[model samples]
Target: MRTDFWKKTAAFGLQDDAVNILSNAADYKSQVLEQIAKAEQRIIITALYLEDDDAGREILAALHQASLTKPNLKITILVDYHRARRGRIGESKSEGNAKLYCEYNEKYNSNVKVFGVPIKAREIFGVLHLKGLVFDDILLYTGASINDVYVQQHDRYRLDRYFVLNQKGICDSIESFMNEIMLVSAATPRIDSRPIADYSEIKLAHKQLMRTLKKTKYKEPRASNKNQLSARMFLGFGRRGNDLNKLIKNLFDQTKEELVLYTPYFNFPAPLMRSLRKLLKHGKKVTIVVGDKTANDFYISPEKPFNTIGGLPYLYETILQKFLKSHNKYLEQGLLKVYIWKDNDNSFHLKGVCSDSKRHLLSGHNLNPRAWSLDIENGILLDDPNKTLEQRIEAEKVQILKHCIQINNYDELETMSDYPAPVQKILGKIKRVKGDIILKRFI
Candidate 1:
């Protein structure tokens, strides 16, 4: 059974000292810049979107300068094709972030190449959500993209888990996937150049790309049992037969003593939520730390103009309240603990898992329906049966919980009656017409 598990996971046999975790977002930004500045061979970045804001420009400029410093430095950036061509929600139509990419390309004389990946025809259905920034052999993995709020370039910030993995073989596999699969695909194209091809013109190639991704897998090396710290990377696409989703469910099922889940959103996929119910019935300790409604990026303050998007935070809060109400008995018995994380004006984007302090998952997967059934997601599963990462894991938990307050009472969460008038109106209309059902699958 043990040998079969190792072969199925195909995890890397890495030393305990090789994995490093950062505490804050500022350090994440500095590490990215430093890695780019010092990289020798190649730099590859994969994210959903890179905003055309101050932080995005700064990072893009760093890549440009790094390529200039080392003429042979290979650089390739991948972002969602639909996201690159369109503006943010509720904004006027414009060329979007591709404009910034084009400007930088022109300034650097086409030294940097940014490819737009058409994961789907539209932005809402699915996206290019592979997370990690590679400089040479080191990988900076986070849910954050190149944005002011994500990297803490300004006063306001978004908190997310940051991990650095130093493994050459892992880097080789990621780079090879891009070099072999993505770059050569007709659906993926350079958005940095002017007069880029339109999605309509390449509809067939786009379908072919999505079909190919659904059937493809990451290049896996030989798996061996080292009886030490190790990591396995898995790609998640559709819900059926998804090895990553199965891995996540397995972690939940295999938890004997405790399980700690970190996510910005409270919406869990139906299957995981059902598993949580069983875990509680079995008397396992489950702790969930989620962001407060105000800590949501879509939150609009009372003084700000209310838009339809502002209702997102309230919708998630409603989901949390429902979960709490259903599990109120477990809460009183101290079998389940829920913490609401809030840090002034900053937002939250953290996502990961820790099972009994032995097996840990580092991922950008939201555990929500959108991520489970639609988006392209990936995660690194670390198995440490000896509890080798106990101190470091506890430290991370303390840092994340510093600004949090436990939900001892289910009534503490706001009800729909407590929402602002505009938010109430929007949510009421959506529920009245049953649009929220559709929204849950895509958002």
Candidate 2:
């Protein structure tokens, strides 16, 4: 049943034998390093940002070492331009990731090039939120950046999906997209002494490139996947430009039995909310797995001094409470499941959707308003209409739920009074001023 659906849906091709779903971040990092060491021809990595930390240095060192051995190896990394040169909001001024790139050029002399791509003029409005790592003929897709927490180099880890795809069509398409589209754009290859003013000089070209990318879709020779599995790539930006959004909503509308959503952030765009409401009304099963408030990356301990961003988890919790309240009937009947992921001091950044037993969305898109209308997002849709990967998907779900606890009632979430003094005071002000609505739309 699903095999036919995938045949009809996939624009390109998918290989069943080549798909490998990894267990966790530590495992993912090891595999990535191994692949990097073995890559012979080229290595391309794209992510939101790459920090200059222990893990980041380790990744760069591996790439440089590989280039030293395979002197002909081509390595290119792309990170958000505005984000690459800026420090954290409250942190003291320092040379950001770009400086590290410059140092690698001078010290390693291994021909590893890091490019900065600005999806929009500034960081607040938009960014280069792309995700993929192409090593020779293999493509590694994850929502994680090369950082200490994301790579799980320490006790703290950010939970995310790690999917490995090894198909000629998939590899070629991604490589072509990087070489022809991203590299040709206004992406800066060297920013050693370049000023922000100089970077902004290419703003018009960047805008034009984004427009072109909005209209561009990966084109490759279509082939029937082995074992009846099919996959397609989708990219989008802004509200209407997002094909991933459209694909997810279509999955919701098409779901016959069950739907599962895994997002670190709890917020959902209006369209998804409407589809979910309709699905629930039709007596379909819906499960939402999200990070606990404490697991939010922005969550600071109540004992710590409050930063304005620290209140984000509370705001999301308030929204979840309202959602649960409005859909209490679904909860009572066991048609709705909400699981909150928490693992001590670890955090979460999972994002994907599974519909019924066939279609799975592996993506970096958070499914939030910001992702829907602001950032450049991309993902690959694996439609296994024949249920070829059912066991794998189910196993992945179990892994994700290992540290999660389901919410039986909305009362599990703390109210304003139960929050820390600073969080309570801050949320109280936002609620009074009706600023929560704005934050929902933007954050």
TM-score leader: 1
lDDT digits (tens) for residues 1-443 of candidate 1: 13224237577777788788899989999999999999999999999899999999999999998888888999999998999899888899999999999999999973679999987778788888889888899988898888898889989889999989897767888898898888988889899998988999878988887777777777776645464887788888887867778888888887899999998888898889988998999999999999999999889998899998899999999989988998999999999999999999998899998998988888899989988978889888888889888898899899999999999878999998999999999999999999988887876
**How much is the lDDT of residue 46 in candidate 1?**
94
The CA root-mean-square deviation of candidate 2, after full C-alpha superposition on the true structure, stands at: 2.3
Clash count, one per candidate = 0, 3
Q: Write the residue-wise lDDT of candidate 2 on 1-443 in tens digits.
A: 23233233455556667789998989988988999988999999989887888888899889989999998999888888888887776798877777787787778888787888887777888888889999988899999988899999888788899999886677788888888987786645455334433565887887788788788777655654454676788886878746667777788888999999999888999999999999999999999999989999899997787899998998888888889989988988999999999999999999998999888988899989999988888888887878988998889989989999998877777777788888888999998999888888878
Pairs that collide, model 1 = none
User: How large is the C-alpha RMSD of every model relative to the true structure?
Assistant: 1.6, 2.3
- TM-score for each prediction? 0.97, 0.95
Model 1 weakest 10-residue run by lDDT: 1-10
Instruction: Choose the strongest candidate by lDDT.
Output: 1
Please list the C-alpha lDDT of all candidates, in the order they appear: 0.88, 0.84
lDDT, candidate 1, equals 0.88
